[model samples]
Target: MSETQMPAGQLSGNVLFYSKPEPLAKELHSKIGVKRMDGPFKFAKVGHAIPLTVGEFPLAAVTGPIIFVGDEKLPIAVMGLNAGENMFVKDDGTFESGIYIPAYVRRYPFVFANDEQNNQMVLCIDRNAEFIVDKGYDMAFFEANGEPTEYTKNCIEFCNNFEVERQRTVSFVQILKDLDLFETKEATFTPANPDGTQGETQKIAEYFGVSEEKLNALPAAKFVELRDNGALGQIYAHMHSLVGWDRMIALALTKAAAQQPQAANA
Candidate 1:
């Protein structure tokens, strides 16, 4: 199975990769740690979209297009053209090397859960993560004295940074929403006909994007505010990332061509 074995009746919240998340505690997990595992990222193989922070737009833009989705206008990095297909992730579960990987994916197996009553965030881990293991494994969660190990502290700090970026993304989205800059858009592709004629354009996805018309139409004062606050750069990053749609289409065609022979054999 591609997905993790989550606990029955457990709410998954928003993260698609996490399953069986548990609060990390020295008492409960004194021996728990992470180690290199074959197919460590296989759980993410079927996921085409991952949450993106505003901080990631520039780097993520180069790899794949970023789009806003749903009423929330949540930003996501588009990694594949269809469901259950991640072009960047090899069959062995290792994401393609020499390409930008989102912090959302790198921080996996560790996440934060809000302690609602305490008004605090608690560090949690996917109890069923393939890398999680007993003692003698790499990157132990705690030292013998019960303090968090350096590795664990680093992971926690990374999660904390992600939370900060995530909050910043919320503000960015709010600004776009207040400016009414969003436009509904569709991803389309036209395949070449066997006779070398132009084919009808096929729509692949429907999503929300920053409307260039709306952006250019903004009041001068509003445009200045966006630039002064650095949102303009991120907006441009997102817009530039739109070109990655063509890259995705190319990868999809390549993968499809490779599969045809296997299908014929079967």
Candidate 2:
């Protein structure tokens, strides 16, 4: 498909950390010199469901609800309830102050790519990123000797660390799946009408989450095994993160009201 036709989570081939990623080459690097990030999140548009690693559950739990996305059960931070809207992002493009920022968002503009032919990972940058600058910048991808600059080295290191955490998250999700701990869940929202009456209940989303009943029914030895393996904490963290679902609904309601022409006129 063409770049414009790419779905959410998928970006142009040159965009790293996107669902479809292409290698960052020296040629592209030359064109995009050391540009500093322009806005708080010019790269991230509305409705971007950022993938969360196992290490991020604690902080992410406080910022937003963490839930499984497709059949593979990939965990994601819910940034918006509806399509094409990010409630956490202000009109100035800055994220809400004091909210816990997920590592997935912090590692942006840099990512690791799988080099299948060489059986290795390659550090890459999004050539189309808003932060890229061709000249008059403090950072450079390569020095005069063609060696990577310190800035490039730091980005590579962060991408490598994120990759390691991503792999660990895969293992964590696999264990949950093997134990049959996940179940379908739904989040509902009921808005209050202007007349002081309850509005119709709306089911905003359906996702997969840890089954509390199954977790409680696990054998004592199995529970001990999970605790020993450090999976129990992650599970509880995910469960606790559900508390943010209501918060998400409230934000979504506020956004909806703000967008309504009638409300705007009032």
Output the number of the lDDT-best candidate: 1
Candidate 1 C-alpha error for residue 181, in Å: 0.5
lDDT of 2 by residue, 63-108 (tens): 7889997988999888778766666777665788877667777776
The alpha-carbon RMSD values of the candidates against the true structure, listed in the order shown, are 4.3, 5.2
lDDT of 1 at 110: 84
TM-scores vs. true structure, each candidate: 0.91, 0.86
- TM match of model 2 to true structure: 0.86
- The local distance difference test score of model 2 is 0.74
Model 1, 67: alpha-carbon shift in Å?
A: 0.3
Kindly list the per-residue Cα lDDT of model 1 for residues 168-245, writing each as its tens digit. 999999999999999999999999999999999999999999999999999999999999999999999999999999
Number of the top-ranking candidate, with TM-score as the measure: 1
Query: How many steric clashes does model 1 contain?
Result: 0
lDDT of 1: 0.86
